[model samples]
Target: MLRSPKDPLSFDSREKIALFIDGANLYGTAKTLGFDIDYRRLLEEFKSRGYLLRAYYYTALVEDQEYSSIRPLIDWLDYNGYKVVTKPVKEFVDQTGRRKVKGNMDIELAVDAMEAVEHVDHFVLFSGDGDFRSLVEAIQRRGRKVSVVSTLTTQPPMIADDLRRQADHFIELAHLESRIGRDPGERAARAAERQDRFARDADPEDI
Candidate 1:
């Protein structure tokens, strides 16, 4: 059985910690696991573990759009103690005549982590990208601990083996589902509230 968050092997309460969340990666992993992360719960979980110096969330935004699906989540995170870093996604057409949006925030996250190392004793990286292996190794060299949060419970696994091995500790996201997962009932309630609001705003003639 996987250990819980309270397990001593997971974190040191006395240490100063910082969280680096790769937003897109985390969302993809959680969706793959058939769950949604309650960001409030996730922050509270780690805050209870140690002195949470910072919690940084990174993502790419579709700038030209009048509305983005991610905007609300980003706003919520920003208002609720998370430092959000975002950049406009670049749209391009390939030789195959397919359009694509590129918005990788790996470099931004790495730079922030490196800058934060001086103030934090523990780094909790919420990403499965193997490209961060070098960043993890560098942080470890600074005499601080690094804990990676990703899941291996999925068929192909969400975490990269190289990145997993590079970290000083690995905390499977599956083990944290109980603490950070969103309640289905809460989601239903929110949906109902939205429906009620829509009904209130509806035109009588349209109805």
Candidate 2:
């Protein structure tokens, strides 16, 4: 069973904390809020909260595509403070002969969280997937406080009731928007610059 923290935890330089982000889930949530995540700001926000030992981001990439909409964000996160874990998205033919996209990082995230539990005082998870309820239970058993960062604002609730009830604390993502949301004008200016550069340095195959 999961239990709530008795008190708000403090971030001493010695308090070990690790962040495990479910990339697709987090991206979906952020997209719903109409903004790109400023990973740098995300890192700084947590670093100020505790001794951040690691920040892991997990995503499945659709390889063999000419271009992926999420490629740039993945690249940016890789070069930044995040330790990005990516695997090629698997495509399978279903019984109905329909193609299905198969890419879930739940197992991977759980494994990492379990491995890091002993090393960290606090574990922060950026996902609302119900599959993680057991993972949270296991982490809590290790005596490490686990905080689930998702939202209850969306219809049907973005967080699973079981998971929320099990966590040491629940942090609604809406509360962190001001700390992580990218400025619209700044994003627009960057996009415009990229378009201009693409036009100027076009290759025959690049188009």
Candidate 3:
């Protein structure tokens, strides 16, 4: 399934592959597809492709919250197969006194990718941010095949044109959903329970 315009299919198994996951980017894509990812399946899917050396997940957390929405997902990934990297999102007031959230993991992702370039044979990035074009180019310069994963189904699509063009292979997120999507019956049951909870907590007028 790993066809490329660059190299032939004669590459060996020791050709190490690494996954650089942009947490927010991947979350948004999955949310758009209406399913949660089965991380175990995702890992197995890639392991079948080649030697998987590492899977790195990067995200910024909102500090000082009583509870964060992403906490459970982060914990799950940490215990699973991923190398979870997180940093607290900084809150600052701009010159106009508007509160702003600053949490960009581009530098961290780039550094890790560069460090792994020496040993990795393939790089798979789970983001569509155009800023990574240069980083992808750097990896390609080292003769590693770079695969970019993001959706092409949305109105404007999630991937940047230049990034898609630069990658050796561009895998759309939709194609991967079947392998990671939750069962529809289970999803409906969960939604019904959530709605029931909301109804029990609210006045009839509020509904």
Clashes of 1: 0
Tell me how many clashing residue pairs each candidate has. Answer: 0, 0, 0
lDDT of each model, Cα atoms only? 0.90, 0.84, 0.85
The true-versus-predicted C-alpha distance at residue 150 of model 3, in Å, is: 0.4
| TM-score: the better of candidates 2 and 3 | 2
**Tens-digit lDDT string for candidate 2 (114-161):** 988889998889999989999989988888888888877788777889
Off by over 4 Å in 2: 1-14, 92-99, 201-207
lDDT of 1 at 27: 96
Best by TM-score: 1
Model 2 / residue 57 / CA error / Å = 0.1
- Cα lDDT of candidate 3 equals 0.85
| Error in Å for residue 2 of model 3 | 7.4
Which pairs of residues collide in model 3?
none
Model 1: lowest-lDDT 10 consecutive positions = 1-10
Ranking by TM-score: 1, 2, 3
Best by lDDT: 1
Per-candidate TM-scores read 0.92, 0.85, 0.81
